[model samples]
Every structure is written in C-alpha cells, then in structure tokens.
Target chain A: MKVTDEILNRFIDGELNSEELKEFKDELNNSRDVQTQLRALQAASVSFKNIKEDSPAVDFTSKLMLSLHKKFKSRRRDSIFIASVASIFVVISLLIIVYILAQIISAAGPNSSFQPGLQVADIFEKIAQTFVSKFSSSSVSIVGTIISFGVIVSGYFYFDFLKSTRSN
Target chain B: MIKLTDSEIIESIKRGNQSDYSILVDRYKNKAYSLLKRMLKNNMEAEEVLQDSFLKAFQALSNFKGEAKFSTWFYRIVYNTALTRLSTKKRKIEMEMSSIDDYEFLKSGFDIHSNEKEDTAKMVNELINRLPEKNAAVVSMFYLDEMSCEEISNVMNLNVTNIKVLLYRSRNILRDMIVQNNLVEELR
Candidate 1:
C-alpha cells in the first residue's frame, strides 16, 4: 500500500487509529522513503520546539508577574472607581430627593406663613405661598411626599442590595 | 500549607490579593513567551506580546470560569496578542510603502533567510519558522504544546475538523519542506 501525503500527515499528527498506526509503523520500518518523510517531519517539529523554548529573555516569570501586578492593580482601581462613582450618584440622588422633600415639608407645615393672614411679600413669597396653599388644601401633596420619600429610601436600599449582591 | 490552583490564584487576584498573581504569572510566563516568540518570530515583539497577554488575562480573570485549563486560556490570550501585534505591524509597513513597486523594493531589502541548522533539531525549527504563520501556529500548538485538536479548536476558534485538517496539512508542509531542503538526510 502506498503511503499518501494524507496518511503521512495523519501519522505525524498522531491521528492514526490502532490499525493505521500499525500500518504506519510497518511502513516506516520497511520503506526508507516513508522513514525519511517521518524523520524530516519529526526533526522540523523538534527544531521549532527548541527555538521557542530557548528564548534568551531571562527572568521572564518575574517580568510577567510585575506586569500582571500592575494590570491587576489598575483593574482593581478601575472597579473601585466605578463603584465609588455609582455610590456617589446614589448619594447625590438621595440628597436631592431629601432636599426637595424638606423644602416641600417646610412649606406645607401648619405654621406655614401662607395662611389667610400671612403677607405675600414678593415673587418668592407668592411662589412659597402658592406651594403651601396647594399642599395644605390637598391631600395629594402629602401622599406624593410620602411616596417620593418611600421611593428615595427604597432606591437607596435597592442600590445597596444590588452592590452587595454583585460583591458576592 | 495550601497549594493554590490556577483558578484559586485568579480568584485571589480578583479579590484584591495582588501578590498571589505572581504565582499565576510565574506558572505561565515561559510558555506564553515561547508561544509568542514562535508566532511573531522576533524576541522584542514576542516579549511585548507576552506581557500584554498576561496583563489582558489578569484583567479578564474574573470572567475566566475555568471551563478550560488555565494554560489553555493563557495560550489563547498569548496567541491573540501576538497575532494582533503582527497584523498591526504588517499594516503599518504596508501603509509606509504605498505602491506595489514600493512594497517590492522593501521586500527586496528584507532578507528572509532560513537560519543555518547545526543539527536535526535546528533544521526542524528552521522549517517550522519558514511555514506561514497560521500553519506554524497549528504545528506548534499540535506538536509542541501537545494540545488536543478539540482544545486547539476552541483556542483558535475553528471547528475541530478544521483543526484536524490544519494539523494534518501543516505537518505535511513541514515534511515536504524538510525533504526539499535535504534536512531529512541531516536528521539521519
């Protein structure tokens, strides 16, 4: 049987089955041409292996470790940065909601000077008076304030929950 | 007392144990460098690619689920990094040489000689390096690293059959090159 290039390739790549392997080995032993082909392929593979393995750079492990350290540190720093930014955003959003609620509450309280006897001083006074009057007369503002506060607190808690879950 | 696994080392690094990454890098550095050196055919570029590969691996360590062996994942990174660098360099050279005439002129100056092989082993390297980069990669991965065709398929993003065919063809190419160059006699 002739050893085609395909068979020789399969033999070289170790893709041969038991039967094929036996045949290949028999051929290699019996035929000088097959033996020559196998030897050349094996030698070429060995040379490539040696060139790669014998690179001159010394302390490659240490250098790689140094670069890995820098990379890990930078990645960690980036994660921390992103986490801090997200936390700041949450904090800022909470603060803004809280501040808006505080202003609404101060304007809506019973002692709000926007009652019938109170003076409407200027545009600021008129705006404040209008805001107080709306809140005092209607239950909608109170409900809205409660829901908004609930939403803000829930958002904060939810963000914290998400952060903890992600960390885990 | 504990012998840390590669995944464990990666987890430690992800959890901010920067020092533990040294073990991971130390474990894979030489192999990665060797892969890059064979792929790029230049020491400086190979070293740079090796560093970049390790750095990329460290950065993406969190995503590594250990589905494959750590070395396989590391080798994939090294292979990609080296290929990317080579392509970029090739593109830059092409850009610098505008016309076909310019490219031919540049190519004439570039001496792509097979190194003098002192022995069978050296002749093998010469032939492997003389192969096209893709074929060389397949040959190296199959022969030098001893990776399974399936694993190489995953690493190279080719079908298993494709990798098998590539390995087959690449070995034949090397065999032919060696015979043509009269290196088989040298091997004997």
Candidate 2:
C-alpha cells in the first residue's frame, strides 16, 4: 500500500474508518517507516500533554484582574465624559432652539415690519418694556416661587454633595 | 465560591456586575498564558499578550454572540494577539514548505516506541517551539487543549480542511525534526 502522509495523518487522528484503520494498523505493524512517523507524532502530542510546567504564574489572575480593573475604570470615565458632553450639547441646543423660537414669535408679534438694522438701544428698550409689562403681580409671585424652588433644589444637592464628600 | 457557566457569568457582567469578570479572567488565564508562552516563547511577551487578550475579550464581550463556545472565541483573541505581536517583531516564519509525501515521513530510521512517551514528551518543549507559528498553534490547540478541528478552525479562522492540512504538516515536521536530531533513539 502506497500510504500517503495525509492518510497517515488521518490515521493518527482517528479520522479513518474501521477498515482503513485496521488496514493501516496492519501496514504500521509491517512498516518501520510508519512506526517511526507514528512515534514522532505520538511523542509530540504526549510531550505537550505531559508538559505540567507550562502553567501560568500563580498571581496571573490577580495581575489580569488589576489590569481589567484599570480598563473598566478607564472605560467608565470615557463613557461618563461622552455622556456629559452629549448632555451639555443637548442642553445648549435646546436653549438655542428655544431662543430662536422666542425671537421668531417676538419679531412676528407687534412689529410687523421689524427690520434687521434696528439699533442695539432700541432693541434693549423694547425687551425691557416687554419684560416689565409681562412681570405683573401674579408673574412676580410665580417668579418668587420659582426662585424659592431653585434655592431649595440647589441647597438639597449642595448638602447631598457635602454629606457624600464628608463620608468619603 | 459557586461555579457559574460562561453564559451566566456573562449575563451577570452585563447586569453591571463588573467584578464578576474576574471569574473569567481566573478561568482562562492559565490556558491562555500557556498558549501565548508556547507561541511567543517569551515570558514577558506571553504575560503581556495574555493580559491584552483578556482585556480585549472583556471589552468585546458585547460583540460575542455565543455562536461559538466562549473558550473558542476567547482563545481566538489570544491567538490573534500572539500573531500580531510576532508579526510586529518581524520574527514570524514565512515557510515555503513543499509537498511532503507520506513515504517521506515513513523512511525514518528512528524507531520510537509509544512506551517511551515520557522520553519523547521531554523533547517536545524545545522541538515544538521550533515549528512555524501557524503549525505550532494548530498542534498546541489540537493536542494540548484537545480542541476539535472545527473549534480550531473557528479560533484560527481557517477552514476545517486547512486546519487538517496544518495538522498533517505539523505532525510530519515534528517527526522529521525528531529523525534529524536522532532524538527518537535517545527518547527510546
């Protein structure tokens, strides 16, 4: 039998069927070349399996954990930074959108022919008049209430931050 | 400490329990390290590659679809990391090995018996490392980890036929090396 290397490889890997395996075994028994090749393959496999000293360092996991911890922290910081930037951009965009809408409504309201070349002083005077007229008694009370609410919210967050920092 | 399956551990990690990832690190460290060590043949490089692969695996966990076993996927990363490092160092083997006939391996004068497995095994550390990285990887994955050809194919990103061919080539090369060194008799 003109055995090929591929066939021998398959034989060693047990990829051959019973008949082929039996035939190969008979040939192996008869052939010193087959025996030598098989021994070489077997030795390589056995050596790797018997290589008990190829294990990792005992502190390997600990070291990996440390690196992983730093990675996780770095990832978290990046996420937080991205989120914060996105939130700031969203807030700024919303403010710009609201301001643009307000300007459109204001320009469209009383001054039907509001021109672009209006003086800065005239623009400020118009804005001041509008604010003063809009700030009636009920509006003033509403503003007071909003200011009080803002103070309480800020105070709550400030105290919370102080408490957390102190505990730390 | 209770044992959890890889999927379960992954689920826990997904639930914001990052510390649970240490379990995976602990589980795969040795095998990953050994494979890297065998491939790179450097302790510091092996350790660096091991750590890098683990970090990469953890970061890419969300991309893992569980189509393959976690070990295969993770080992693939380890293998790739080692490959990249070797390539960067320009020490990667570029073999133009010709067709090795079956009879070529069969003409060996060395008569190594399987009973001398220990003697043969002793020569493997030095002998196996001399193999080209690709064949060395295939051999280690096949014999050391007992990975199936399909799994090795998945990890190595090669088809099953190619992996089989690598295996054939690796076995022949190792056998040839043994004959050249006359270690077959020494190991006898």
Q: Which candidate is the best by DockQ?
A: 2
Over B105-132, each residue of candidate 2 has an lDDT whose tens digit, in order, gives 3234434454354545545665555556
Instruction: For candidate 2, give the lDDT of residue B63.
Output: 92
List DockQ for all candidates.
0.27, 0.32
Candidate 1 lDDT, tens digit per residue, B12-109?
87787877877877666666665666667777887877777877877788889989898888888887777788778784354334432222222222
Window of ten residues with lowest summed lDDT in model 1 chain A: A115-124
Counted clashes in each candidate structure: 3, 2
| Model 2 CA deviation exceeding 4 Å by range | A36-40, A86-93, A100-168, B93-122, B177-188
Off by over 4 Å in 1: A18-32, A42-52, A59-100, A111-168, B1-4, B91-120, B180-188
Q: Candidate 2 residues A1-168, lDDT tens each?
A: 656788777876778998888888889889998888777766544455665436667787777777677666666666776798699999999986676556656775675876544543455677688778767775888877888999999799767855654443
TM-scores of all predicted structures:
0.65, 0.70
Please state the Cα-based DockQ of model 1 relative to the true two-chain complex: 0.27
Q: Which 10-residue span in candidate 1 chain B carries the lowest summed lDDT? A: B103-112
